[model samples]
Target chain A: MLHEPASQSGPDPASEFKTRLGVWMFLLYCLVYAGFVVINLVSPTTMELTVLWGMNLAVVYGMGLIIFAVILAIVYDFACRRRESALADTPAKGGKQ
Target chain B: MAITAFLIFVAFVLGLSFYLGQRTRTSSGYYAAGGQIHWVVNGVAFAGDYLSAASFLGICGMIAVAGYDGFLYSIGFLAGWIVALFVVAEPMRRLGKYTFTDAVDAKFDSRGIKLAAAISTLIVSIFYLIPQMVGAGVLVEPLLGIPHHWGVIMVGAIVITIVATAGMTSTTWVQFIKGSMLIVFSSILVAAICYRGFTTEPDQGGRVPVHEYATLAATEADSRLTVAEPGWEVVETHEDAAAKAAFAKLARDGRQTWWLISRTDDGVALKETEAVVVAANGTTLINGAPPSAENALRQVGNIEQLRGETDVKSGSISPIELLAGLSDKDTVVKRWKKASFTDADGGKATVYYPTLTRGNVLMRPGLKFKVQGTVLERLDFVSLMLALFLGTAALPHILIRYYTVPSPAAARKSTIVAIIAIGFFYVLTLFMGLGAMINAVINPADSNMAAPLLARSFNSLLFAIISAIAFSTVLGTVAGLIVAASGAVAHDFCDRYLRIPMDDRQKIRAGKLAAFSVGTLAIILGIAFKGMNVSFLVGLAFAVAASANLPAMMMLLFWKRTTAKGIAASIITGVVLSVGLICFSPMMYGQFGLDPTTAPIPFNNPGIVSIPLSFIVLVLVSLSTKNRNSGVAQPA
Candidate 1:
């Protein structure tokens, strides 16, 4: 309901901005994920390095990716909510002026 | 106790299905749960539907056997949800009606869209269904004492009932319940495994060394063996009747010839040992010894200490301590290494043996996806990861799930919740799978039994609970797939393309019949693909989905010039190419009794090629048809 007009006719400014925000964050996450894969492929032996509570590099990195996804989801939800509320608060007369 | 638990679990799911199915009268209700499900509930249901037998049994088994390489599946599958959440979740809810094809054919009234989308949906859904069914059959063998085919039939019958009765309404509730139970039960299993800790030997007793044979050379006529790895060799010629009978039994069982205790001299001698056999009339024999349950499925236990540890045979340790202790380079861990050799009959037989591996080596990547393997093998690994990463958003069953929620916002929130639930469960798989490995709870021959066997190690009660939950997991996923496949048949093909003169009531009826047919097909495929790792089959599913569906979806959403022809052509091309490559890949060649080198495809996964091919076809077709505006998103 917050972006109802965007759903009806065409893409709205707020929705477009949110899309951009999400895609950027997604790309950043992809880079981090790709780093994990590249490391495993090119220099797999490096994963044996002990890191964080004596867990191997691969374990820490794998778990870190999971935790990071959770964090991004929460952050994206709050930011979208804040943006929606901010847009809803803008006056109709001020918008045209 | 296991039967009771399994029956109670089945009864609960059936009751819920009938209750929800009764209210599902409308076509919308039957196909998409009337779009009335709560976002939170739908979110959990997504986890239930997404975490198929592959996620539970297959991933656990892979980790138990292959270590870190197995966990890669868990990571790739979870990460794919991010695509679902951010890219496809909201737009799919806004554009689609019942199936993912609805979203693709939203603007274009082209019959090509309907036909191509329907075929693609059927292919992808059936490919995905095979793994879930195979997993069902695998579970039945150990849990229910029934044959594999019978188990597949039961799952097929149960899932068809769920889909035909209530449709998405029943499917959603089943998934929600099963998903919650899967996570809770896995946590309990992991806790139990950690609390018990590791032991150097099996809990019951130590296995006595009956005979040790260092195989030097083995042929049909004669077998040469040594007492030790570098000891003097002794030739054993099969001239006597008793010795020949023992050699025949060993050959029949596909076991290697080894040293055995000599009957003439009361000492161990180099000879071919006889294999244990179960007669057709129920008699059992193992050389001169009585038949024992040791030949059957058995529990594997972990070691408590390393070669020279102070706290030898410690009773319990924290989960963190268990993994950390196992990571020590000096710790000797039992890892199974599989190899195929030419038997006496000149036939190749793949056999697995327990190899003493260093703990650090066992925990790394080279075990399954070999770093120094053939170039094609490395590419196959990367290609699989790519498919799993990109496939989640494009799957017909997963995409159709967005329509079950009420609004676009609801769909987005639901996807986030699903990511959380799925991500958490995947993390648990790491501990549960590693526990199975350290405890030696996995069968060297069949990796699919790892988790269930691991639970059996603690007690039969936990085993029953875990098996019942895994069965439900298969049920939930299969029901979702059948529902999606049926929608493609009845709605996309039957209604749109065939132009069947039918009311809403008739449409729902057609869907139920289609559901039955798809379920039957799934049962047959499940039986045929038996003995394969569920996760491996799922990887193939992901490849097809990513190749056939993802490109069309991405172009439709982001590109303004994508035409109806583009979407249809891309989907058809993607499906044909991926399936063709898989059929000719080395993996399939091995199954078909053909030389693997004769296969045209270099790697098993076709996503790396098919996905890009789909994208290029869509781009070229859309550009060629640029001037003939179809009135759907034509350059702003």
Candidate 2:
């Protein structure tokens, strides 16, 4: 008997691809979020400048972070579903299906 | 009317729980809602479970008082869901059974992993529970006109019934309903706020005079001024007492009195101020008079002047117009601050003074976070943001929601839904908070009532509905937390770790008992820690979860050299270090009725120090035990 992930009966073909995609996206988000924190620490006065649409950088940047998360999530979900179906249509290489 | 609405809401939630209770007899049904909840429903339920009282009441209240600093919480909180959606959701669903503990121990099958995870779950859940319980009591005071303790007990009883009856099934439905209603009603409230626009004379239709400062020329030490005022006399005077301001007690009708203080200036110019005195006998006097139908604490926050307009109102403006109006240089927003002192008769008195802040300053981040202050203050702000970003993926109640979905795909889809829904709701919080700040609806003594009070300013019916939704918000979050804690007790601690011989029915019974006990404990702590800020408490909870759970969970899933002993050691280290830092932190020292400045730890937040340390400990321990645990199965 071979050990398997607890929630699955057999191995998932797209598991490695999904993990790689997810980790890359996670790192990207971490960098953007860290930028928000660093700006507040290094020079918070920059946040007071009206950067866009007559709103301060603080308001613009904060709202932008929230809206950006939703966009990224939608894209991630779409890409993962495509990869999952693409892998499912191919025949098993070695492990029992 | 508000009471009626609150009662009806409670009845509907209770009835729904009992109806769902009939089908949840099996251990699986009780624990994970039979793992058949729809992706869409579970998605909204995730919103319901995540937007606790801290998000709704605490954020709104903080924004109403402190301006853009409060909006930072909204940003940090929504950022957390991104971590959940991209990193934790699919893997957590694929690796766990009932609780977060199940996932960490799935590869090892070690008792040490089970014990460490279970204790971590219980601690995080309880710490999270305190704020929801406290917010419930705060809502009850104005909504139902009851003491704070009674409200705590009432919410505790209702939530325990919800969790003990049908467990996850009823909890999920409650959260779904709450999530939908919260988003819909909040949208309606935001539309109303945009319609009202900004106004300079917010007290135009009021019966009482506006509580504005009155400046007068100081003549003699004890005698009346040359320009005497009727029904007012100076009874006592103290020179340069508070903040370099000379103080004088002005008596009215020989019984009631207000404060007349003058700041540092070449001339002696005294200004009349509002004061609330709490007598040793427990009676409260507002503005030198006992509160009654005629005399009460006046509603405070308002825009003193709108930009490019003199004494004119901007009626029915657009949402963008509202924000632009708040950021204009010429606009002036009135904010209040309180200073406390012992009066002549040994009674505690707090004087409320107004500062006319520039609109540009109000829309920026210096009011609460104090990022422009010392290095330690900046670190505290950054540490809090770090915790909020990392904490959501590690929360026990949130992690278990993945198990309620059928597959990793469902879990991933549901999390995306949660992010979109929760993100949109957070966007509305900014408008609602700013609306409350400019509408003169804020209660000077308690900022927590800002949102509900802003609704009341609209109409009685909207007020009643919003209050009811707020109460339901408390109910949903508390039920989710209780279920998570009970799962730790029944499944992780008893059945697996202790190797207790228990069937499905017996495990379900044990879970119910745990739910009851935890609920009772929540009630007692809620009443005990009254008057504390709810959002601050939630921040501490997030730090604990980030420290204790995240390091272990991420390592177990991704690191091949991870051992059971290493996971357990990291968890214990994270928990002890985070909890210890918080206990000795300046904020907790203030809560202990001591001088906060004398605390050993300079900062209040602990995430900057604890979270990284936890990861380091895990890596070192796992490397040392690599050879012994070589055969341990890695998670796929």
Candidate 3:
């Protein structure tokens, strides 16, 4: 996001972008989690409804949340790497400082 | 063979500690392992340090009893690491020296920040320590046949030795070894559970008796007690006025068996009742039979009764199949209940009886957190979830791990590793808990022994390995907590607050001394808090950590206007409010021998109230002191 490759005078645009992405990702996950908790409160019996191959909704959803966390972390790491590479390529091409 | 395995494990850890201690001479090496640990190893070590007795024994026990509600803790615990990885991990590594206080006080060199942060760390460390100590006591009773108090003291002494000798260096190595072993052994255990499959009885080939609840007739009664209901004999009775009064009141009220006993001249006869009791330690007496090894632990399991499928009494099943089979409503599951009543023949007898449950109901929530619970009960559940979700990043012991890695980037990478390891282990806990439940391996009296007892169901060898690993689990976690507490005392408080300028040698000395003091205190608290579930104690610890430390931490990292005063005020408020609320909570009132209704706090968990209160205090205090804290908000 910035022309400068390594300068720390202000918040690096790449870092800022990553931070924003991270926060949004976190919020997205939180929404899913909160939805689960709310459902548990509002109509808890829904958690017992079978959604998968004979398994209840709560088990499937709980397992999905755990898997989702791993996927999010992996995505963030990749994005950070891509952003680092983009910054490296940008310094040579020259853009906004 | 079990004793041998446990001995071998203890010897290996102590030997490793002394070897690591030889290399850790400087204050930095002693406190932060010289910031030289590899990120991957440090990450696994994080798992080792974080998965205390509570994670292994307590969660499994809760799952064995409460089913799905227990896994909620695992979810809450793992989710918190997301905050740790993305938020606290990097900044903490960049800012801090040794202790959590170092990180909080990095931007502002105020003495108040140091004192408040240090005290907060001590309070959290002590709170976290109690459960680990209690777990240790619980383990030793079954493993070595030693008294609970002695077991607690043994753990305290061993952990102190580990912390005092090599400090963070040895602690890290122990954690790494412990973490790896725990995962490997747990995986093996899960494989065993899936291989053996589910059975109606704890013993593989035995058949579960289809016993219906029966009524027993009391032939006689005395002044101490009388049988009000025919066929339901009241066997036990207490002559004590308070006991009689309570029983008579309950019986008169016609509520659930209030008067459990009656006093007879010949002896006390117990009210014959049937329940699904998670049996306690010792020989389990079933149907008033003689206490024997076979009936010692209460057994529970789900029977698959699919629409077309004939009843398969016992067979091997995959994890998915196990859950699916359990989800079938027609399947029967057994649960135990313990009822204490005065017996005409036996005074004050608590009997374990099996209660039949539908498989689908066992698979859902509401066993512990009822769906029809009151508003406050629901709020309490949410509050616990919030605490667990927010507590990981703010834990003093967990935060101190950031300083163990070389750089901020390493800290972040290590946190990711910790997350994966921890997350996987939590998933494994579900199968372990279910396995314990189905196999009837639970110690009915103390649910904390469920996992280890589950291992015992298979064979003595596997049981030995799992129990020894569990012992190591306690040691690794307690050692880390002690190290964190020592850093708070010798470094944060003594150096920063009291302004004790010590040479490197003296700094190490002070840290060792501090470790001893904190370890002793942990031992005492552990003994005092016997019989309480370790996971419940850990939940309280999370609430305190999230409330007392997380608000200040998040503000300092993200808020450009955060000041020292705000941080200090938030810490004090969080600690005071949460601890104070816990003291007046219904649970505490029960401990104090008073009616739960008399307690001022309606909620069991203080996180919902305390966390928000902390954030508000931080914001208000920071705005008021904005002028005095010039340039402190800007990161160097």
Off by more than 4 A, model 3: A1-17, A85-97, B204-311, B340-347
Write model 3 residue lDDT over B1-636, tens digit each, in one string.
778998998888888888888888888898889888899999999999999999999899998877888888888888888888666776667678888888788778878888999999999999999999999998987789899999999889888988989999999999998999899989988888888875543463343453233322233433544444553433333343322222221122332232323335754433334322123434333434444665443444334344224445546678898788777777766665555544443334454444556767777777887654999988988888789889988999999898887766567778888888988999999899988877756656677788887787777788899999999999999999999999999988897789887999999999999999999999999999997757767888899999999998889978999999999999999999999999999988866668888899998899999999999999999999999885366642
Please, what are the lDDT tens digits per residue for candidate 1 over residues B1-636? 888898898888888888887788888898898888899999999999999999998899888887888898899999898888777887778778888888887877778888999999999999899999998988877678899999999989989988898999999999999999999999998898778776665442233221222322323223442244343333332223312222221322333332332323333333433233344454544432344665442333344347446245666778777767777777776565444433344433333334456767766777878665777787777788788889988899999888888777778889999999999999999989988887767766677778888887778888899999999999999999999999999988998788888998998999999999999999999999887656757877888889889998888888998998889899999999989989999878876768777898878888888889999999998888877855455321
Please state the error at residue B605 of candidate 3 in Å.
0.7
Q: What CAPRI-style quality would you assign to candidate 3?
A: acceptable
lDDT of each: 0.78, 0.85, 0.78
User: Listing candidates in order, what is each one's chain A TM-score?
Assistant: 0.80, 0.82, 0.78
Q: lDDT per residue, candidate 2, B1-636, as tens digits?
A: 999999999999999999999989788788899888999999999999999998888899889889998999999999999889888888888888899988888788877878999999999999999989999999997777899999999999999999999999999999999999999999999999988777776652353345556876656545444214566677665443434444567776656555545444564556656678898888999887788877777778888788857586677888778887788778888887666677777778777667678878888888988888998999999899999998989999999899887888999999999999999999999998998898888888888888998888888889999999999999999999999999998888988889789998998999999999999999999999898878878988899999999998888878878887789889888889998999999999978878788999999999999999999999998888877874364865
- For model 3, how does the per-residue alpha-carbon lDDT over A25-85 read when each residue is reduced to its tens digit? 7787788888778888898888889999889998888887787777887787777667756
- Name the candidate, 1 or 2, with the larger DockQ value: 2
Instruction: Pull out the clashing pairs in model 1.
Output: B199-B302, B199-B303, B199-B304, B200-B304, B300-B439, B300-B440, B301-B439, B302-B439
- The clash count for each model shown is 8, 0, 42
Q: Assess each model's interface with DockQ, reporting 2 decimals per model.
A: 0.33, 0.50, 0.27
**Better-scoring candidate (DockQ), 1 or 3:** 1
TM per prediction: 0.88, 0.94, 0.87
lDDT of 3: 0.78
Please give the lDDT score for candidate 1.
0.78
